[model samples]
Target chain A: MTEMPATEMPATRFPKEIAPWDVIELTIPVRTDLVVLARLTAATLASRVGFDVEEIEDLRLAVEELCLSLVRNGDDGRLRLRYTREGDDGIAIACTFEAAPGRGLRELPVDDLSIRILDALVDEHGRSSEGGHKRAWLRKRRSRTVA
Target chain B: MEQAFDISEREGTAAPVVSVSGEIDVATAPSLRNRLQARVAGGDTTVVVDLAHVSFLDSTALGVLVGALKRCREAGGDLRLVITEPRILKVFEITGLTEVFSIHPTVDEALEAPPR
Candidate 1:
């Protein structure tokens, strides 16, 4: 068995937060390798948004959950990420994808365990219909003081 | 893209309870994370994440739990993990998380502990 080169691993552009903070979006192919890349990218972005060690971990988890949801929905298209900064509170991130009916994210019962955990990881979350696509939005609050 | 495990958690008066009854591989770890996050969001700090029913656990799953503990602490709370199976406990022990977080022999013990 041969090993993959470090550079061959999934790599994406790191968006810069110029105006206090701006939502950075990226499109990556729906592949497991890219999923790991997405997770790492989210971690880097969270750090840039002034997340502490703990907050970084939370962001990573959020990204993983979002990507996992996409994978489950057979969202093998492009993975979309929206990164934004919420005033004094923290950064808001959204990872979305397109899925067919009864395919994307079914509304887990309000008391559902997974839904509850996803909500806790982020400060704000919801689902919406846009352009005949179902999207899941997740927000991560920055714990550090904005400079 | 892969099939993952199904995770569920319930909070009692004393401790929060978690039930993971499937494969906790990369595909299913997110569900576990999602469920764990929900519990923390509801202001339930002292948590008992039961791993007894789980047959599998990977690094991603471990990361999810560790992150959950960090979140609980930030919110002035803590997490207790229950691992009755030897395989799961071995992972905790190998990862050194066994020393980092409180691990109980049963879910009852985890839930019974006073909130931190």
Candidate 2:
């Protein structure tokens, strides 16, 4: 893969309340650039943790699904993302948007065919309500093997 | 933000190859389906689709693939796919297409794979 120049990537900042561990959060306005950024980030994370090609692919799919979900339901102007390390080979990613009728992930169940595939790809995934904000979180644990 | 679709046809020793690139979204899928249909109608049955550059594929895009598969089978031709990118391949897997279509790791491999 060609190395993307640092200048090609835009500078971004997260809300003051977001933690420093959140890669996606630090890269706010990740909506339009999700496809490429998510794939690149997954590839980097996978390589860092020594994941196989198929495992890396699975991580890309999970990130794509998350981005798709956020784009479909997120607030128009900006969205906040958060990530935290869970354990060896595991990372938790979350995106918070305004709490509105369609914005609630409680109604955005993962029963669909796409979501089912995403569920199989990740170690753990769910959504939580924190009063004013709803967060969809997915835990990805790097796999040495493709399975 | 990008070209909706692009097609390039090359004549191999035995089969004709059709390379498709870019997003296969709701708005762009029809053009892709039409391109394949036109090739199948032109009596080119053994057509291979190179999807290495495709960034996204939705349900409508899968429908086009299935339709092309059916059309090729009816016309006594074969439809094969060359997919190296994980993002596009994930769409095929999510749609249970790995079992339906012959997927090749590289375009050269797909071109060399024996016709069905």
Candidate 3:
């Protein structure tokens, strides 16, 4: 696959204190078969955040890309996801794995295609080992229309 | 709470056609690889993959298609794809696969297009 240069995207931070009502959490086994649960949750949250239909679909697809990348390389574990609402601006979804054993942070999908997809779909996409937690995340902003 | 991922193929056409429905992710992409590989190994390199009914597909699915495309070209045949879903199409467009494979909006169109 041909590698495309990474496109620089505007980064947004997840809220410091997301209200309980502004967040949704789900923990599921790191199985490819169950990643659909994450996609479903993404759609629901995007809709609640006032994302357009097409944007909601993009969010779902973006979430699928992130979740599948984690589950495929991960061993027996649980994927914990935190969906934080940035008020009326956008939504940020972060995923981290609690590995069963021999757990190490796997890099964000290295496939050129997966990287391109993530770059195109979300405003911020990345992987990190912050505070000893292997985390992957993507943040999408609702498209704003001006009259 | 059922996750649907199904594939149906018919070899009666000049080029066999595989119609797939539901999401195609890592878990189910192998099924797609197996079907396409079987057809190619059986000497049917010119196959039509219809993804009209499929609403979602990811990189794993893309990898399977790329592999099949390589096998088909090496055998003097090609894999024509019918994908009308904009969301799925965007995946191809994003990854530059739009230029790599022969994509059509309909099966009939894909079947009639000249092989790449």
Q: Ignoring the other chain, what TM-score does chain B have in each prediction?
A: 0.86, 0.89, 0.95
Q: If you assessed candidate 1 against the hidden native complex, which CAPRI class would it receive?
A: incorrect
List of clashing residue pairs for candidate 3: none
Write down the lDDT of every candidate, Cα atoms only: 0.63, 0.63, 0.82
Ranking by lDDT: 3, 2, 1
Q: Residues A55-138, candidate 1: write the lDDT tens digits.
A: 776666566665554344344466677776554456655666644335544332121223434555676655554555445566
Compare candidates 1 and 3 on TM-score and give the better one. Answer: 3
Residue A59, candidate 1: C-alpha displacement in angstroms? 1.1
Q: What does candidate 2's lDDT look like per residue over A25-86, in tens digits? A: 43444344344565557566665656777777677667656554544423443445565544
DockQ top scorer: 3
User: What does the lDDT read for residue B105 in candidate 2?
Assistant: 84
The residue-by-residue lDDT of candidate 2 on B16-96, one tens digit each, is 777778766545677888889998988888778888878766555676888899899888877889898877787777657
Question: Per-candidate DockQ versus the true complex?
Answer: 0.05, 0.24, 0.81
What shift in Å separates residue A29 of candidate 3 from its native position after superposition? Answer: 0.8
Residue-by-residue lDDT tens digits, candidate 3, A60-115:
88888777555554477888998988867699888877776677654444577777
- The RMSD (Cα, Å) of candidate 3 is 3.3
Could you give the candidate ranking by DockQ, starting with the highest?
Answer: 3, 2, 1
Q: Candidate 2 - CAPRI tier?
A: acceptable
TM-score of 1: 0.47
Ranked by lDDT, the better of candidates 1 and 2 is 2
